[model samples]
Target chain A: MKRLRTFIALAAVPLVLAGCGDLSNSSMSTNSGSSKSGSTQLTGQSTDSDYEGVIQSGHYQVSKSRGVTNTQDSGNTYNLKSFENGMLNVSKKVFSTKKYVFQEGQYLSSTTVQNWLDRKSKSNTTGLNPTDNGSKSASKRNPIYIQALEEQDYMTQKNNKLSLGGVTIGIAVNSVDYYKKTQYGATYETKITQAAGEAYAKKAANTVLKRLRQKSALKNVPIVIAVYRQASNDSLVGGNFLAYSTNKAGSTSVSKWTPLNVKNYTFPLSSGQSSPNSNDASSFSNFKSQVENFFPNLSGVTAQAQYDGKSLAGMHVNITTQFYSQTEIISFTQYLQTTAQKYLPSGVPIDITVSSTDGIQSFLSRTKNEKKFTSHVFNSY
Target chain B: MKRLRTFIALAAVPLVLAGCGDLSNSSMSTNSGSSKSGSTQLTGQSTDSDYEGVIQSGHYQVSKSRGVTNTQDSGNTYNLKSFENGMLNVSKKVFSTKKYVFQEGQYLSSTTVQNWLDRKSKSNTTGLNPTDNGSKSASKRNPIYIQALEEQDYMTQKNNKLSLGGVTIGIAVNSVDYYKKTQYGATYETKITQAAGEAYAKKAANTVLKRLRQKSALKNVPIVIAVYRQASNDSLVGGNFLAYSTNKAGSTSVSKWTPLNVKNYTFPLSSGQSSPNSNDASSFSNFKSQVENFFPNLSGVTAQAQYDGKSLAGMHVNITTQFYSQTEIISFTQYLQTTAQKYLPSGVPIDITVSSTDGIQSFLSRTKNEKKFTSHVFNSY
Candidate 1:
């Protein structure tokens, strides 16, 4: 059984105020990073629960700083989105969505973030990166350690007016820094070790926390801070959050940290390459083979695994095929589910998406706590 | 059987060039208008089909004029998204995703869109709306007829190059023009009749088409134009696409028009009002009651139905409850599915989303061509 966590109500607003306007971006950002704006629409009279309240709608507001920070931070969209959403989930651990409403980071201005993203220079003392050594060589160059910073605010409605109740900051560090030695020259990259990324993020998080306290409005606001190791520029999947720490209201510094110890791996490592996780890899291999062997017209099968330390936490699989008949889709889904239960790791939440040349045909998932699988098949209109 | 439309293979691009970078927007656009960017992600080696090819991903580039046009077109996000996406779907129907790649409008400059969105005056003769009347009275004031205009371009890849194959124009006409007769005074809205909105849109689409042909690059490109009826400022659900027309290549005029005849209705009308859709409404009412009577902790049930003329085309239902047990969720989902299959109209694609205070618990859906429902229960992490 999972241990229960305490949720403090903090403060509640009187009368349900109609939500504000929403903005949807049909941005063709990469697959992992794409998200739709808006709270799920509910008839004004729908029933509510504490867990549901935490899922309340906060107007989607992009920081004025977004255009610059995101573009310059990582060339990969999946990394950008993963860094953002992963950080937000960490914040929810402490802020308790039911107690506080969400708002885009408002106090931090765009220029401030721009300054913090740069390498230290005489004119830009606020730069979070180490000062440049002027070396073009990869070994000597001060690798761009920090990629981007994001802030999200949690608000409490008191006396019918909303005020900041807490703040969460996400510091994204580089996994690999790609650079050009000369103008329009051949680009080179320096891979950043995990230890190096973690160290830089920790220091940066601390520096940001201390500076945030300088502002009177934030001195007493509870804050959650997290660090994310971004995916490599050429990676197919996104990065993961390393860890998080919380600074309770009236506390100025974050003390104890909780290591997320999460890692994401794409199934069937590129040809000839072996994963350190051979055990889990073989389990996935067995499952993949069973599905493909049973279905001859299979085009390909791919999976992404989320691991918590050495334990498999979650799995997302994508199965592409050539079948069109509804009967075939149903039969294939049932086979895939049973095969997955038999060959894949148990207890880990698993999700499967089945599609053909006609777009998505069906979906199936088994949650962490559930033994039986739930399935959904998409049909033509 | 649906009539088969001929898909002219205009041009084919060779070799799958790896896609460009992606950006995900977590914009919280309102309930009706939210959209995610990017073509759905597929494994590198997925099988392909013709209908599926039409769903190809083009980089989601927003028009440079988006900031100004969308914000001003409708203060409501739902209207903004509806106008943008509804127009895209119409374009897809003509351009056929199998042959043409989608792109955000790039040809029209922001300044040009601004000028066209303005009312006709001595300085801006190209203005699509009538010149403003000086009178502030409701009867004398020239209501702003055109809310916003959106352009989309379809491209065909040939020998590694992408070229414009077709273009689509969307004209959002006002359903209700809310104007301040004076600054900071009482705000009143003038209801725009359906006939009025349709007339202005048809005329405006023609004018824009003729002007677009002036550009050398567009002279021979096929064009599709759609006119949308925007939802009123106070409406809970969004408005619909009134009609569309196609202007074939080498043609300067749009000769034929097709009325979409699409309307969206929110089920379980507010007290004292009767739905013109009493036939479909009672079906939903019966389904709601059976589930509610069986499970007493029901908070509320709401639905949205799409009608093609008078026949129900699709239905989406949201069931809010207070149940918790995994067994209860599975059982309730089972019962709900059985009840829905019996009470709701068959042959119409229907989708149901069930959520508790704990968030989404399960989902059930039936495609138009499929009689039996496919379901998935979303268990917790």
Candidate 2:
């Protein structure tokens, strides 16, 4: 707390510095003076060739140089020379990649989801093992429960156009239940209880798109959002349940809630355990089979599942979806490109133009040759 | 400890991400694929005028444009356009004043001396308060201590430089202490106490430096080593001690330690309290009289004492080094021009060529203006 107090005091002193001079007046006056000189000289000129126009085309590059200057006082003078460079080469690197679109009901998850959420919420719970019921620890005893009550909530969205290697992703975060706590007995509690399950599920979907951005050539693609609820009685050693609402074709409201079918599906549990060994495989497989029967045309789209690893460990379900049209894909791609260009380095630009067949073949050939050379270099190293 | 362990674990993962990327042959080979046509070109050419040059001139300008880049993929693009124009301008303001250097034999006293020492030893006893007797509380139960130890220490030397006017000025610090404390207890207990004190002292010095770095413009500066010890009772309330030392004459050591004079300086029992009011017509007048007696024959220098609505608190001493030589002044003007050019808009180059009289006049004018502006601003705000 003293360090925190020290930092607060340190931060407060800057206000005293801010009132020292009118930096704006100085800069504006300096700029005005410089502009006048430029207008008078008219010595410098720029052309399209000089600019390379990579920014317009959605690409970027990096370069460097060195220079010298003079310093003086009284009757003495000195020259100072500096050598400058950057850690990453700006010119050759890609700042953003082409876009990719996910079809209706399709989902993708990032490997970072489970780990990030777990670490972030580990201190919230009071239970010795929140994910393991056998631990027999009181659930609400941990500080995490209090923190969770005041934590912010967030959502994730897919944006593959700005990604390199055909992956695009974005997240929307919001504060939820912030600064609030529950009271029990004589103490007031303020901890995060449920570790942002909804946010992580959305994040998983976005991550897959990010990974695909670099490899895909599409742009301005559209994405569809699908929501699911985690079913109770799920365990790390057994199978897990997922429920979703489905509307009838004729009726747009008051749809029935359906559980996914798992027939013919064998879910893995830990390194050596299987759902079948726990005698829950039959039920999970039946649920999977039922979902398939409901959606017979679900194919061509990617599917991913997210779970509280501790509670629903080992068992992963792939709820597949349908593909999107070319027009929708293009629209989503454009949106992604715009987002990527906004944040990407000035050098790296997204390439949105459709490639010709010849161009694709040539690219493949060149890639093969480059791969061979790379292999040799790697082996030598 | 558990929280610390979790924090470290979370931090380590990000660091590992930096090294996980492998540039294998397979990866390199993939780079040859023909990207979108014309997409590989670099945009944004390097111009003679760029903020990087301006920053090297020792002047910091705040621009609407974000000065730092975030690599966390947070998807938030900073927009500087919304900030007021000219907000980032930094001007070179001069002060036609003299600086007084504290030389050997100058004496110092007051609560500030004790505060300075306490601050210097802060790191060793972090999270622990010093005892009422000014000894580290950790070993205060027993009394009667002696024996000097080899301690590392630092000293602060403030150079007259451009500052955001009206800001409080203080010394740059570097210090280390190596010493022993004797206890009336058993010899074994005495050894343990001394060892702890020495270790704590070293840590305290480092902590003080860390705190000092948070001060404006003092971060990352070179430091000098010094020897520190508790003041003797004879050097207390009415006593005096030498507070100055001489550097080795011919050696250009950046870290040369100098002894300072101290006398009649008593630690304040409460924060923000100063010495008893001077009996002179005015506190400032009394402070000026004392300064003159402390430093005789101080000509060609302007001195002023500052007060926080009480007794004299500190003094501002400036000395005129030399009149400018035409050639030297010209070179200095050119340096200023070049520095301005670096931050100026593209295609703008500043050329400064002023006669000796004009150059000197300009420097004096800016200095006077800055001082006047600072006084008015601080007084009003």
lDDT of 2 by residue, A341-364 (tens): 332112211121111221100000
Tens-digit lDDT track of model 1 for B1-381 = 001111121111111212311112212211221122322211111111111112122111335454545643345545654565466567767877556655557788888898888899999998998888887777678888888877777767544345688888888888888889779988877778999999988988888889999999999988899998888876655678999998988687778899998777778877776655687899888777656533434447888777778778787787887652333455466546545776788898798878776456678888787765666654322
Predicted candidate 2 versus true structure: per-residue lDDT over B1-381, tens digit per residue? 000101111211111111222212121121222222221111110111111110101111111111111110011111111010001110001111121111111111223223333422444343222323555334443232211111111112122111222111112111112223456542322122323433443444444444434544344433222222232222212111112112222222323323332212222212464444433123323222322221123213232222224433322222222222221222222222222222212221111112222211111111211221111000000
**Per-residue lDDT for A308-354 in model 1, tens only?**
67777777788888652343455466556545665677787788877
Our model 1 lands, by Cα RMSD against the true structure, at 19.3
TM-score of the second chain for every model: 0.76, 0.20
Scored by TM-score, the top model is 1
Model 2 reaches an interface RMSD of 31.4
Q: Among all windows of ten consecutive residues in candidate 2 chain A, which has the lowest summed lDDT?
A: A372-381
| DockQ of each candidate, alpha-carbon based | 0.02, 0.01
**Local distance difference test, candidate 1:** 0.64
Residue-level error in angstroms, candidate 1, position A188: 49
